[model samples]
Target chain A: MKIGVLVSEGPYTHQASDSAYNFVKAAIEKGHEIYRVFFYHDGVNNATRLTEPPRDDRNIVNRWSELSKQHNLDLVVCIAAAQRRGIMDANEAKRQGKDADNLAEGFRISGLGQLVEAGIQCDRLVTFGD
Target chain B: MFTSSENIDPDDEGGVIKKFMFVNRKAPYGTIYALEGLEVVLISAAFEQDVSLAFVDDGVYELKKGQDTKALGQKNFSPTYRALEGYDIEKLYVERESMEFRGLTEDDLLVDVQIVSAAEMADLMVEQDVVISF
Candidate 1:
């Protein structure tokens, strides 16, 4: 099955990101193809490289980055949502006159149209939220 | 649990029409969830999939009439519910228990919706291929 995951909340505050991560890992292990993981609302915060937790704790941002690296996953954060919460890539940072970009590795900021496209293209669209 | 050894039916493959249900359980304006949920529904409508909408809990407030967000300096999005039918999205289900809990009636709603029991709504959700909650 081609699965598309939509995460709508940030890590720690909500269980959405963690649930999505676990589901994605399980799906991949069961021989399913993850077409895309589209992050919206506070979920865009997951793509910010500036996030740093305790050394002993599980790094959610790094986990997502590593998962994307290992599976060549398409991780897309909503540009509109990201801009509202200050998550930007280098091009967006330059255009918006920001000091620096903090978008984590293996994630790209895109539009909500990508979410719609993912729904149509993928066999199943699963959403994780508060 | 799904297994790799299990054979997938050809009819249930790539081109199969999927039932997509957008479940709304939050109130409007207070959080960005309701508005963003609407944005997703609008985008999903263009895909021409089997789509159904459910309004439960505080989500029933999203369809209430006489919504004046101007006091809060927010956009009045209550009127947008009326335009959903134009996009070919006619299946709108509102939970009876939720409405009763909130003291809301069908007459108070801006748009027409099918009033269903909580059990009926759950059954509908179970029938869906995908359920996106907001």
Candidate 2:
């Protein structure tokens, strides 16, 4: 089955990102196709390359980026939410006249339409958040 | 103004329209969930899908009439609820128990909605292809 996941919470402060990662990984292992993983609300924080964790702690942002690389996943961070939270790609940063861009690898910024499209096109749409 | 380059016309995809329900369970102001969830609803309206908004728990407060955010310095977005009809998104359902628990009635809301029992709401939810809660 083709599935789409929505993650709406930030990392470290919430377990939503971790749970979503595990769920997506398990879904892929079980032969399910993940159409996309949309980061909305605070979930867009997961796409920031600037995130740093303690040496012994799991790096949630890198975990998502690595997972996307391994499975060729479509990791989309909502542009509106990203901008509001200061998570921007190189282009967006330049356009908005920001000093630097921090969008992590394997994740692209898009509109909420992607989330709606996932709901329409995918067999199921699952959400993880507070 | 960022848009999805892969945005496809629903008609091009064989016109497969699915039931998409947005479940609001949080208060509109205390947290950002209600407000942000509404953003998705507004965007989804452009996709021309069978969309519905369900108000449950503290979410019932979202539709309450005469909401004044002046002192709080927040934008009073309750009026946007009434504009949903312009987007062709009129299927608003308010769970009866939630409304009663909050001591609110249909007359206290800003927009017209169908008051449904918990069982009826469950039936409607079960019939949907996607149900996103906030």
Against the native complex, each candidate's DockQ, computed on alpha carbons, is 0.25, 0.60
TM-score to native of every candidate shown: 0.87, 0.96
The deviation in Å at residue A87 for candidate 1 is 1.4
Residue pairs of candidate 1 with colliding backbone atoms: none
Shift of residue B15 alpha carbon in model 1, Å: 6.9
Global fold similarity of model 1 (TM-score): 0.87
lDDT of 2 by residue, A1-130 (tens): 9999999999989999999999999999999999999999999999999999999999999999999999999999998889889999999999999999999999999889889889888998889998
Using TM-score as the measure, which candidate wins?
2
> Which has the greatest DockQ?
2
| lDDT of candidate 1 over B9-100, digit per residue (tens) | 32333564678788999999899888888877876665677889999999999999999887899888778789999989999999999999
The 0-to-1 C-alpha lDDT of every candidate, in the order given, reads 0.87, 0.92
The alpha-carbon lDDT assigned to residue A112 of candidate 1 equals 73
Cα lDDT for residue B66, candidate 1: 94
For model 2 chain B, where is the 10-residue window of minimal lDDT? Answer: B1-10
TM-score of each model's B chain? 0.88, 0.92
